[model samples]
Target chain A: MIDLMQFTFMQRALVAASLTGAVCALIGVFVVFRGMSFIGAGISHASFGGVALGFVLNINPLYTAIGFCVLVAWLIGWVTEIGRLREDAAVGIFFASTMAMGVLLVSLIKGYQIDLFGYIFGNVLAISRNDLIAMAVLALLVFLVIFFFYKEFLLLTFDAEMAAVTGLPVKWLNFLMLTLMAFTIVLSIKAVGIVLVSALLVIPAASAVQLTAHFKKAIIYAVFIGVVSCWSGLFLSAFLNIASGATIVLTATAVFFICTFLSPQRRKMRRRIGTLVKTQNS
Target chain B: MTTPVIDLQNVSVAYQDKIVLQDITLSVSPGAFLGILGPNGSGKTTLLRTMLGLTDPFDGTVRVFGKEPKKLKRLREKIGYVPQQSHIDLTFPIQVKDVVLLGRAYKMGLGKRPHNQDREAVEEALELVHMTDFADEQFGRLSGGQRQRVLIARALALQPDLLMLDEPTAALDVGAAESFYEWLHNTHKNLGLTLVLVTHDVGVVSRYVTAIACLNKRLVAHGLPENVLTEEGLQAMYGCDAVFFHHGKVPHLVVSTRDPEKT
Candidate 1:
């Protein structure tokens, strides 16, 4: 594990995993809070469509994936605004159709022998310099957006109607959050793939909730857990010559289990505290 | 005489083909406490949203301070709203102070961060509602009444000139609900702000509100509580007749009614 860091590819893999994990988990806090887990799923699958479209156009798959994902994100936002259908239902329909379209596009590509499994399951060690640079830019954007609109996002996620009433441009902020989620998904797609990307986004936060009741603490715990899993998975995958994405997810899963087991339920803890207070006074 | 802060001129809203609020005209003066009374699906919430410009009217105009509600971006700075539900995840990790700080997002905008002013406003707001002690508590850890108070503090942090509450005590116990209404009126009086509350507890809130607006897909009536709470007005707003009785044990009026249209 120590010797693995000696290689450049291993180093790149570590960097990619950390950045991707951190960004996804941060955005995931909103996603989970907003109950937009399905939206994340939809965007990830839609990125697959972008990949196929890129293959068809003979361009870099990342560009097409990001483009298609963003376009789809905008469409979902626009359609939901039409007020004709529930947002989740609209996103679900868009996702199903886009996924099928991308699959068909991929199947039609001439001599499609690559199998394209990497885009689905991910190949973190295979990240190019360009991909690393893209991840960096995306990480910066994610940080900026989260930092800039932290208050508005908090209000919107918790109570959009109240946010709107408070004059925060709730509609626009919601659209922006959706767009950013798409952007984050596209950026992390090459690292964890669509199937597992949401794991990076949701699991760490869920686990963090077990240990802390404060929003900021939960976020801090999620980032800490995510970075740990990324580094550990990167090294473990390198030494074992296994799939980096899968290994990272495994590490996260293990973390979640440990946290869940050790973390006490809040209600029970409160009850115990009440008893202790009574005993101390008596 | 003071100018009206909210003016609704023939405003109407429809969801799909079904109209929720028809052309309704009403005006509320600053510092007036207006209680909106209606049954479920009576467009009480829609009326409030229209006033806030969160929902667009199909016809006519709604104005806040003589300007269109849409143009009231700055007007929102002067308005505070406590929704029927705060919509925050109980499981999400957020402290009461953090939730309260969200009220200043309008004044804070994109690049700037919240400062001492915002924090002080949050503290003041919490203090007004008697929830200052819970300022450091996690939002999810609060009881229903405690959570409601926190939400009210979030709105109050705006230092609004107009305060709108949608069923503020909907999920609270009877005792808690009464106390919440008391605090609401007390705050309104102390701040000298316009207060609009949506409630089914018409008799209880009638004393607190300066006027009452009864809505059932339209503005059935709006006037002093004595005029708006008449039998006809109550029947029109609720689609049923109400029985009024006073128990010596309880100082407040108790109203019991059945389904309106059936009778």
Candidate 2:
């Protein structure tokens, strides 16, 4: 594994994993806090349509995926704003429709397609220079946006009504969040694949929330967990000749479980229950 | 008289296609402590939201600081708003001090972190609510009354001339609720700020607020509490069976609802 770092593909894969994990985990904090997990899942699945269209039209799938993901994300945001139905309901509809479109589009393509399979299940070790550059640029853009709008997004996630009443452009901020989420999902698709991309966005944040009572600390922990899981999972997957995405997700899940087991809230609840039972018996 | 800070003339508001507030006209003067009284689903929260510009009215106009509350960022800055306790997402993992600090974000301008002055303001606000001890506590972990106080501190941290609270004591215990009302009354007295408190608690309205607005999809009455807290006015807003009275020359207020509306 140490010697493999000298190879460009291994290096690119490691960088790709870290970049995807960090960006997704950062956006995932807001998504989890705002209870937009379904949107994350929906947008990732929806990006599949763009990837399919790219294959069908013979264009770069990244552009198409970003376009489709943002459009679907905005539509979901619109549905939420117009109060048409619940945001999750909109996601549920779009989730199935996009996957269906992707499947039909894939079927239209000729014989065996290994590139399409990579998009579906991911092959981090097969990452190219172009993919790495795209991922870095997109990740940097996300980081800049998150950095600039950190306060607004925090207030928005904590309480959007207060954010609005405090005179923040909550509507614009909300749409911006969706756009960022869309971008994060698209950039992440190559590393984790369209199928498990939401997990990359979700698990690290979920684990972080379990470990800390503070929001800022939680975000830091999420980024740490994300980068650590991705890097270690890449090494472990290579050593075992297994799938990187699956190993990374499983690693994150394990961290979440450990955090849950050591959670102070869980301990507090256990103590409270013990006292209650003892008093009742007395 | 000093100019009214919040003026809504013939305002009609609808939420989710259901008419909530209709033909409402209200004026809050400086230093006036006003209570918005209603039963459940009486559109009390909608009225406050309309004033705060969170909910756009279907008809008429809502003017905060003589401008549309929705359009004027300055209007939002000048008015402190505390939404309904349930409206907050309890799952949000935030500390009490951070919540209070968020109140200063707009004042600090775009893309700026909290400065020293903002930190002092947060501490002052937390101290005002007697919640300095819970400054580091996670907001979601606090008890209902404690959370209520933290929310009030967040609003107070804005240092606005006008403060509007929607059912602020809904989650508070009896003792905490009384203390909060007392502190609010004292703050109104000392700061000379306009306050609009929305609640179904008739006793609270009769006790703390100097003025009253009884609501039931319309402005049933708005005047000094003594002039508006009559039995007839209570019935007008809260169906036919509502009551308000005194026992043996002692001041007492009770409201009985035969059919309480769902919020």
Candidate 3:
């Protein structure tokens, strides 16, 4: 029963976590709907190469990771356009190889940077002003990208060939969508580790889907779920002296299960109070 | 008659190790309903893909309005497409209006929102398909026939001069399929839009289609239904007896093949 307003770090942690959660879940709506979950996963791991490169080069890891992730996102789009290979297989090979390369690079660097583990699993307590600013900018970018091309991306995801016939550059628009997804993945990577990034990206939206029939409402609900998970996880982890990222993911998973179980739309039959008693007695 | 809107001359398409289409030549006249008929593996889809410029021909060319199909941006504006129902996963959460709005993607300028014109077109397309009431509905909840109508509205929203539908009635009940065909014919006649349908049901679509192109591994026949769907043509296309059953206006071709075990 601790008051949430007392500590400055706790407040910052809550704000940062909420922002990251909302952004990931917002983008996750598209990821799950577009069947781009594999690509989203690939981008998360691929950004590891970027982060490792930043460490080896003594640069701001966030900038380096964002750049690297965006580049790989474009590459995935290129391969998909060429149609020389299956999209999922191509993304799998590239990300797996890049992740291996990243791990190898991390070990090869001179000193033991223990902060690396924090980046992978996240340290919500260590979130800085710079991280907050970066998250805000990336979140804004995601909003704009989604707003401007909502129709095109929607059509591209559902039926690309028809989108193309309508004169939309379905190939280029798809590439742009993947690129945005990469940026969103990179933004969440610092808050949630690469391994758990997709959880942040997917869980809230998955939960929201149980409650809403409209895409716009689903997005709004997902963002709400995301913010709740982030703040609750931060507060609970602080109380328990536990890892924040894992705690937040666990919270989101719980929310998803609860929503799924209690979803009225999913029930086989509407429950009347009298009917429930009759069934139980029978 | 006006010059053919689509003309393919000796077009061929190949995958890594295998050729999917070979030396195909055809022309689709303006405002004519052309049906491309073939069996499952007969490369009808490949031909449509090549025509759309999504697949490059190994040799020869595809022309839309006398320009290369891939390079003609303006010409593409006049083309609408509804690919096979199997190609899309209905679980994706896209609204019907959002799906229809995709038809405006090509016409929309960079950074511009869908304007009044686009909205009107979407509305009109929905009205034409009798789906105006479901504009707000999530596409995933629609029945198969309803989904097909939404898809048709999406294509129709493009305001294309030519519409290509690939197995548009696949996985539909006979009543639903016949109604779709009737809607397609009405739209084609009313709008003066060329309609191209790729299907296995030549007999079913023959009445609406002004012409038929019977294909197996090759162009077996290409002409009026009376000429292209003869007994010899049916045997060549199906490799068996194709019994034609008529229910007033519609024809159903039922294929009965000899047992392969006996052969």
For each candidate in turn, the interface RMSD (Å) is: 1.6, 1.2, 2.0
Candidate achieving higher lDDT, 2 or 3: 2
Our tally of clashes for model 3 stands at: 0
CA lDDT for candidate 2 = 0.86
Model 3 residue A142 CA deviation (Å) reads 2.2
Question: What DockQ does each listed candidate score?
Answer: 0.68, 0.73, 0.58
Q: Write down the lDDT of every candidate, Cα atoms only.
A: 0.83, 0.86, 0.82
Give TM per candidate: 0.92, 0.94, 0.92
Summarize candidate 2's per-residue lDDT along A215-275 as a digit string, tens digits.
8888899999899888888888899999877888888888889888887788888999999
| Maximum-DockQ candidate | 2
What is the lDDT, from 0 to 100, of the residue A90 in candidate 3? Answer: 77
Best by TM-score: 2
Docking class of 3: medium
Q: What is the descending lDDT order?
A: 2, 1, 3
Worst 10 residues of 1 chain B by lDDT: B245-254
Q: What is the lDDT of residue B25 in candidate 1?
A: 92
Q: Where does model 1 exceed 4 Å of error?
A: A264-282, B246-263
